[model samples]
Target: MPFPFRGFFLAGLLTLLLISSVQAQSVPTVIGARATLEPWSDPIEALGTLRADESITLSATLTEIIAQINFSDGEQVEAGQLLIKLEDNEEQAQLRVAQAIRDERRNALNRASQLLERNLAPRAEVEDTQARLRQAEAEIQALQARLANYRLLAPFSGRVGFRNISTGALVTPGMALVTLDKLDIMKLDFAVPEVFLDVLEPGLILTATSAAFPGYTFQGEIATIGSRVDPISRSMNVRAELQNPEMRLRPGMLMEVVVRRRPRQTIVIPEAALIPEGERHFVLVIHEEEDNRIERRQVQIGQRRPGDVEVLEGINKGELVVSHGVQHSREGDNVQLLGIASDETSVRELLESRRGQGDS
Candidate 1:
């Protein structure tokens, strides 16, 4: 072999080694998201039962036969609306006789007063006539009161339940005739641990969901907090009122309630960005100014929500952290930015969207 040819071969071999090293150091592509300031809240969950704002069972106070049924099953009625008419023929006839007697007594009293003024009647006679008129008036009032007991009127504006009696059906004292409920607003009764008593107060916002109404969230505010906590459960009762103008909510419906508390703005990042090693969490943050190099950082985490986590420390707003391709990333390694994730779109979704665009 010639000496010059040997030297050229050695140089070529060196050049190839350098090229391989450069290729090995090539930046790996990764999906990342910026730590952002977002509104965060602590949620306290509980179970509750729904009740009507006002509810009552209509009943008869006296034994009587129903003469007319003014409403049908499940009818909406206004306050003071006549709902049932009981047989009051005897009371009505007695009232007419009493009224006539009162009218006659009043005429006699007026004549006695006139005679007394003319000195033709004694003062005692006028006083006696006045007493009789008073007695007659009282009798008429008593008969009218009795008649009132025969008529069943709605005490409040609400929807009526199934009628228990029909025309000519006899009802005794305390007999339930129907049910009435004001469903414009619903009351929810729930309990939370006594530890949350400090935060439990009227006007705290809550959201409720019922199995009977899937995907429908009922919004309400706490109306009252019980004065005492339950000794056995170590929980306090809470009552919330929900607007139910459509009457979709009914009494005795079981519901799941979540009360939001301690809301604040905090730094947040995608949950996928977190790498767990025992009790410690780490994230690979991207530094754009330094050729997109990653920095491994130990982070303190607080509450975690779906798809996102609260970053208590070790990150700031606008700092990008690797969300996808985290397994392939390490500290001080250069990375190629695939895309940035936003609150509306997750890292995996964003990667898929980018892939779709490339395919198009």
Candidate 2:
């Protein structure tokens, strides 16, 4: 071969190599992301009502005059705390008399027992004194129990409602004095369709929201499910226990409930990464190594959540998929990976974040 012709051949080979390199570099710049395992679930929505864990109406058990009011309206009280005291002067006097008589009877019984032991008194005399002592003790117990009936006490740790009577007010048995509610823990009652009866059970997690306190959510777990479903509505009553550390929730407030069921971890990708052809769906998956080429693979999808789609088949966890530029790429085509997408943010937001990082 001629030397000039050989030089031309070498130059032509160099030119081809340079052009190929440039074409490879210019292939498309698109956002790509790894298929990630995320929690997926079918959520059941319902409405619920809030109630205190314990609620009761505090009332007087005996007819008496209110001697003292120990608690104000809406006051927080501990278990067995005295809330109101009725006039107990008569009971107190009777109790004191019974106590004195009891002491006297006890001394007599002791003396009789000593005498009997020494053979100075008959055993029948000792038995009579013992019987008198027992009677005195029984009288004291009756008086003490009567005194307790005059006072209204909080049965549990709770907040008291409005006081219905004042000091020196005459009250009768079963007269409403006030209301009390234990607010540390709340009970939420909701109804769910009987169709979910198979999955409905205690210990399932649920969340609730109230229009009264917008943007705040309460977390709880199912505590009880009704054994019988309502025939007319075809729903079952469900009760949940919610923590009330701050006591912000009150009884009778309406709540919105969301019960999560069938939770599982599965491979998921951004909805934008999927390309639909009629009823079929496809995603351009990037090769793990060796090349930046993509494969347009058909995927079987399941339940869809906001911003994400579950890949039932044809995709594996940690495999990269084209998210932003699927319209410009083809199968087996090499492309530029602009950045990795995420379920936390959209592709455009990811680009903005990168631009911000570059500016910073």
Give me the runs in candidate 1 sitting further than 4 Å from their true place. 1-26, 287-293, 332-334, 346-349
- Provide TM-scores for the models: 0.84, 0.85
For candidate 1, write residues 1-360 as lDDT tens digits.
Answer: 799999999999999999998876666879888899998879999999999999999899999899999998999999999999999998889999998999999999999999999999999999999999999989988888888899989999999998767798989999899999999999999999999988777888889999888999999989999999899999999999999988899999999999978778999998999999999999999999998999999999999988999999999999989988899888999898888878587666877887998799
Task: Please report, in order, the local distance difference test score of every candidate based on alpha carbons.
Answer: 0.91, 0.89
What is the C-alpha lDDT profile of model 2 across 37-121, one tens digit per residue? 9888778999999999999997888788888898888889999898888888888998999999999999999899899989999
Query: Highest lDDT among the candidates is held by which one?
Result: 1
State the weakest 10-residue window (summed lDDT) of model 1: 341-350
Query: Which pairs clash in model 2?
Result: none
Model 1 CA lDDT for position 42: 90
lDDT of model 2 at position 142: 88
- lDDT for 278 in candidate 1 is 100
